[model samples]
Target: MSVISEEHVRGGSVFKDISADDDDWQPTEIESLCMNCYKNGTTRLLLTKIPFFKEIILSSFSCANCGWTNTEIQSAGRIQEQGVCYTLKVKTKEDLNREVVKADSATTRIPELDFEIPAFTQKGSLSTIEGLLDRAVAGLEQDQVVRRATHPEVAVKIEEFIQKLRKLKEVENEFTLVIEDPSGNSFVENPVAPQKDEALTVAFFKRTVQQDIQLGIKADDDLDEEPAGNDLETMRNEVLTFNTNCPECNAPASTNMKLVQIPHFKEVIIMATNCDSCGHRTNEVKSGGATEALGTKITLHITDPSDMTRDLLKSETCAVIIPELEFELGMAALGGKFTTLEGLLKDIKDLTVSKNPFICGDSSTADRIQKLREFGEKIDKIIVGELDVHVILDDPAGNSYLQNVYAPEPDPEMTVEKYARSFQQNEELGLNDMKTENYEEKNNVPAVPGGTE
Candidate 1:
């Protein structure tokens, strides 16, 4: 991350490139108000699905009255679980020409120049490093006339800075371009991606509470200005509704959360959201209690169709494996899920086949697609009890659970084991850095690696 000092502003950027387009898709043409001409214009909207990436909406507007035109791209994917930061070393002319996607929720910086572009100050753009610099230069030059007249002293400083910025376009020196996106939507292109572009580095980190508020994931202020305000505090069962923006459409919506206890299990938080704008509904289950002393591993031998109805809770830290099918899903792969055995299997199928957006545009191979489809078919067979398989759920937090059909009788086909978490697992969970013994005994807190004290 670059040290923030001075920030620049730029207008929206537009890119006309498409990695790949769905062969069978059609675009929608509609009449809309034009921002430039203030007259109705023709807006063409196409929802494009990338081979191995989430879908995006490509829209182009043209006004007959003023010959005004504009093009923009909007991601149609869900909000990623973790935010991402991309740092690119613009050491050569090729690096400057690489494509970049700057989400509106991202912050951009030129570390060498000590210049930053705060999030939301500029619109989202699908452009390159050189284009980004060009846009910045244009925005600064736009206000020079007024600045030179009203504030000549400050204007002189800006003029000198502008000249310095233009010199950067010559690639006479190397600089780092950093983009920190709390929304995890920004991108810096690597021409030979998957092969490791030495000039670029990418990292994902947890979003801050302030970032969550800005993204409309949570209410910035107490939303309870009504009689039911005290319900969430006083009543555990009462669903607490809070205003939030829809993750799908970024429109006003509400998220409802409730604490519910599972029989023979601990209480868990269930959150559900319904977006009226796009009619998209999403629900996630999260453990409500503190971390357990040890981790948990549960294995279930599925041989009957009735097993499909068994309830399952896969914690966020759980890794799922099916030895019979030679399948493995790493931790946080499916997130925290509360669903039935059949539902989980279906989700696995959908994710591994239909929704695995990592095809990398044109690099997707036919064999890979066939294999994914075959995996989905195998999962369907498992749901129908056509194949017997052992499903293992390993959770480092000991927060996962599987409903045993036999319950107190101890389902003969199910086995549960408790074991201490490994050091690497503890480090990943930040438990290694936590001082649970005597936190009050410390003076000025020291920062831990990858975390604050």
Candidate 2:
């Protein structure tokens, strides 16, 4: 018989030390990307007003497992891409280091070797691999045109202006150019020709001129106009104003709940409600108005029982909530029905319960057993649906390594009898089966002293 303390009933117990016994599973340096290159691996960012690329990494991968796809957009619309307005390929160590020095770099960097981007572009239309790569490079180059054009009318109008960039890499891995003077003299300087073996097509274009001729093109006097126009200004301002936290207290209680908004589900809503120290409930609404934007907040009270139940069943972790009885139950191994905090305290009363009674690892099972043991003392023949056991790992010093094992959910594909036996063995053996299946004999972890449950 033992007792768990109230302070031990936190989720961090499961979250903090996520132990993967194998050393090979740990992250490696090759898996990490250079933050200075590729804008810390962020290829694109769509803000509340303007949508554009950042001039950092020429390209980076997004997760296909997370359903990220790249598609051409007809309009950036009201929502703008925040932070940097353009992205350039990391052409050299100097270019990479420049991005790293920018300070406010994006955090989406992936390990260079382990990264994969979403591949749903119309790449099939490309007749050759060169054409596909050229299209990607050209599209990226076009964004730079949209970034530095002088004329007010030239915003986002790439077809009229010729893009000229000095190919900075031998294999075209990434590119860079050093601006020689402030009067745009570097734009006129003729870059050294690529080596015969290089696969690079390095040329600078000015308006319609295709190659880097002498410092010949007349410098446009119209460079005096502001960088962004009224429409672009309004868009950038809106993008700058986007709140990534709660408006009232700046708390990060908001979550992106409405994940998808495809054709059939045109509008997705995300809401957050806070009852803060101010004593008033603040509700934030997003996508509930106008078109469904990427980072907006909304509030809606969920009333469906099945939705609540599904949320409860999402994990096997136990959540117990009985302020007075927390210490006793938390220390005891417990399980079943008590997947949530409020759900576990329904039966507690003023009854003189045993303070040191062993609670099973799973709280639901422990509560059920406690109730049954109390009632069966006066009745008979109570059929429990499942059982749980406390699998204690012990150090050589005789201290227990507290652990939990639970009966599995009923499976229709597996016969009830087979399921029962499997579930029973899991409760009895704890992690023995897992160790046998996943661990090799040559690399097995040393056993803890207490053995299986």
Give the per-residue lDDT digits (tens) of candidate 1, residues 1-453.
111122211211121225346333345688899997699998887655443224577778899999988877776666687887888888788777777777778898988888888888877777789888987888788889999999999899989888988888788898888999988887776554223357887765788889988988878873535554454555585787989877655668999988888888898998888988668787788998988999999999998999999999888788888988877765665678889989888877776677654333443457655666677888889989999899999998999999988878999999999999999889767789888664634755664668555
Across residues 1-453, which tens digit of lDDT does each residue of candidate 2 receive?
Answer: 122223333411211112346332221111223333422221332211110111111122343244343423221111111111122334443332221111111111113222212222322120122232344456546456546556445554433322222222232554322211111111110111110112221121112221111112335342335655446334323322223433333334433233222232222233334433223233222222231112111111222222122112101112122122112221111221212211222222211132211222212245545654454332111112121111111111111111111124432221111112234323322322444443544487766568667
Candidate achieving the largest TM-score? 1
**How does candidate 1 score on lDDT?**
0.77
Minimum summed lDDT over a 10-residue window in model 1 is located at 7-16
Per-candidate local distance difference test: 0.77, 0.25
Instruction: Name the runs in model 2 displaced over 4 angstroms.
Output: 1-453
List residue ranges in candidate 1 displaced over 4 A. Answer: 1-81, 84-181, 186-205, 209-233, 358-363, 444-453
Q: What is the lDDT, from 0 to 100, of the residue 48 in candidate 1?
A: 51
**Residue 438 miss distance in model 2 (angstroms):** 7.3
Candidate of highest lDDT: 1
Each prediction's RMSD over C-alphas, in Å, is: 11.4, 30.4
